[model samples]
Target: MQDEGISRARFLAAGLAGAAGALLPAGSAAAKERWGLSYRGVCYEVTDGETAETGWNATRMRTDIRAIKDRLHADSVSVFGDGAGRLKATATEAAERGLHVWLQPRLADRPPHEILDHLAETGRHAERLRRQGARVHLSVGCEFVLFVPGIVPGADAVERIRNLMSGNYDPQQMMRRLTAFIAQAAKVGRSVFHGPLTYGAAEGDEVDWRLFDLVSVNYYSYFQDPARHVRELRKYQRRHKPVVVSEFGSCTYKGAPQKGGMGWDVVDYDKPKPEIKGHLVRSERTQAAYLTGLLDVFEAMGLYAAMTYNFVTPDAPHRRDPRYDLDMAGYSIVKTIWGTENDPTSHWHWQPKEAFHALARHYARPHRRLDPA
Candidate 1:
């Protein structure tokens, strides 16, 4: 019988051999090194509050951006905004940190029919950030099939999400609709903001690469075979264009590695503050291991950039009681706790998991030489 357990590094590299045919020419190693860590970043989130006063957190937001640059060692940051105001606030601060900003406008409660309006608003923010001497790339939207309307046949986001989950829609049809929307979004984004533009394609979504400056994908390709996923990603590095992993991460749980992309929905949101209540086990190392494996693949693959799913989660806080342990549902590297003020700027209010150090270390290493594309 074959040995069932594989070392993390080998496990990540195992699938690359099959991808050799798809890689950039071996002479492109110098180019890959020159483009090292193109977007070493994290997704920073900001949502509109019920009211203006409570809608944003300026103090904490400032602190988070500082920490993202100083502590997290991120050179690029993706500010995920719900509306124009939120995007401006987050992206402006990210710019202040001397990090390139990928300004993305999001619509959580709304339908896909409003994507054009939302992208228009985001373009305004992108222009504003650019005017302020900030390096900003306008990412018009993310995962439209799940977030937007009309692409998947649901009347609203919830219905469409359920439709997707139920496997009740046609995949090919869904792709066509999604492609059309992405192309439209790119067109709209270009009209307002004449800068680098991209759309965060959901993993496994076949996108038209010619429409955008960067080929970005939100890759959470399960936990079983990373090499195979890297090979798949390698195929997308066509036209000598940069391929970016816009978002990829796992949660902090014992079985999170196996949950893959489903980890986010594994816990019920409305059930309670800490949706997962039980004699639950927390696995910081599991999160770290999964990340390290992916980073290994990313480094060897000579991808342009990779932004982890997120940086902080003020919404998800840690708790002593298992019933209130919302951090279990978070993708944040730091586990924050509400009402626990450390009185000043410190990583104390939030606890950094093992993955935090692993990321810092991986990023700090010299860029690996990669095959030329």
Candidate 2:
């Protein structure tokens, strides 16, 4: 499933049992750490805040970026968020640590000009990072049909999603409009950033390959066979460019593997209180297995990079009551909580789900060798 319309919820704290050691054997022999973790959770509302991670705290961000490089062992990170200033702040932290930075501008539910303006502004900052000797890639934007305006007749992403679900729009027309916008975006990016340019596409988006320096897709193996999904990579391979799966993973629940990419849908945001829609068992191992299994397949398929869905979602923190638990519906690897909840004396604000250790081990292996594309 694509990241068509993920409901944005403002939240995060609570506690639950997680299998920090229940790791399934990888689908194939463990390969080295070519994987990059996408940091999609930093949402600073013009305030200061840590794994002790509320928002834009200098000390807290240092720890977060360090964990991505040192703990997760990721060599690159795709940093994105609501504001360009915050996104740049996060990306700058990642860049200083000797990690490749994919500076992605993700301004959702905004007008087209605002989104483009964000990209151009962010691109200039990314170029400076590159010129300063940091490896930076300017990802124009992502999932345009849902995020960008005019592609569909809706004021925002959620409305566009509902309208599309009613199946009343023309597919060809949607792509035609999206394709033109992407072209314009690429042009805008080139005007400000002079490094590699790519745009995040959904698994099935027919973006013109010529417009990107690399082929990027949010390939969530949602209810789909990993092998079948890898087979679908052939068409992308035909593009003769690096193929990067920018967004891929499972939710933290017993049956989340079968739900579509928007599996977090189980949480009902409509109610006054955050509540799980039905009975559900929390299983961090399920999320871990789904990710490890995909890493094995992606390694074997020689994909350039398989960045995970996200590092942490502080807005959707863990909770003790399943009815109130928001982390189960999040795609992050860590369970965020109120800092004081962990320990009144401790600064740590999160607990690792089973996937955390699994990924650390997977990425710590000997370097993987790939055949030329």
Candidate 3:
């Protein structure tokens, strides 16, 4: 009886192996697609009031956009604003220049249905651009999970906070809202994208993988180490979906040894004193190294698309606002190395540092293909 059982097990194992061989497709379908860098784009956040003041001064923003475009040959731009009219005008201008646009409409605290309506209105504007042959991408929301204490300050603060911190938002509810918006946008024949804050791996909870054409993450080097950043990207790639570094930047002002300031203090509204540290000035170099390293890894992994944190300087004044003060003052390659500022004669005008040239060189022309594997 034992000898008969052993022979039967051997026969079953052989048959299973033969079945698997027959099921395997030729060369695993050849991947069907290859991932490559999307043209580097800038993330421009124009607040509601500022757009009103600036009106249609395309030259105001366009000059900076063109400058970066000339430097990097970028054909894409991402702009987010609260005003529907302003967003439309900006998208039109960008499209006319043959630049792809990603429009992020600001919606917070509105009921899901209301948010869906706003997206429909915005999608209609984007569809106009698409009809004219512009590559317009719409992100449902920007960092929707991050609950500003005051914006939604109420009895539900604790729950909202927990939901954000612990990734506790109901995935099904979030997915339903996003899918509704996506369905509305699809009616206008426009493509939609989602941008999530990439603080940790779980930050992507709000996105429904099947709903969008691409998955995007806004990651800044402020909180996590470079290795962790790459690891997170690898995990996303394993899902066979492309990833975008929607935002990336580091603080230039070296703060007190232990309390690293986030370049800006949201609560105090004051810039922290610049504690000169060895690492502060070299941040651009660090940024360049990290960026290049990620690009190398991404290319090798066959990943798609990456966009740096920003191109132009912020409108905030220096020495007063801690967050933008140090960063707008310190980490910038153009500000630190070039000795140029938005105002050349002002004290804010500091020379550019080595990191500026490092970026200029790296992005001046495409480097060798990245192959981490």
Q: Candidate 2 has which clashing residue pairs, if any?
A: 11-315, 12-317, 14-319, 50-53, 51-349
In model 3, where do residues sit more than 4 Å from their true spots? 1-36, 49-57, 109-114, 147-206, 221-230, 254-267, 270-283, 318-324, 328-357, 366-373
Candidates sorted by TM-score, best first: 1, 2, 3
**Each model's number of backbone clashes?**
4, 5, 15
Model 1, span 1-373: residue lDDT tens: 0112213433424354434324545655322434344567788888754333323578878978888887778778888868677677778888877988888887754655576888898798788778878888888888888777666777776677788889989988888888888888888998999777888888767878788888888887753555566556766675467777888887887766566676755456576233674555776777777777777667566677888877776656677765566677678788875555311223325667787887877666656333223
Best candidate according to lDDT: 1
Better of 1 and 2 by lDDT: 1
Error of 3 at 282 (Å): 8.0
TM of each candidate vs. truth = 0.84, 0.82, 0.62
Q: lDDT values of the candidates?
A: 0.71, 0.70, 0.47
Q: Model 1 residue 108 lDDT?
A: 55
lDDT of 3 at 190: 42
Name the regions of candidate 2 deviating beyond 4 angstroms.
1-53, 223-225, 339-348, 368-373
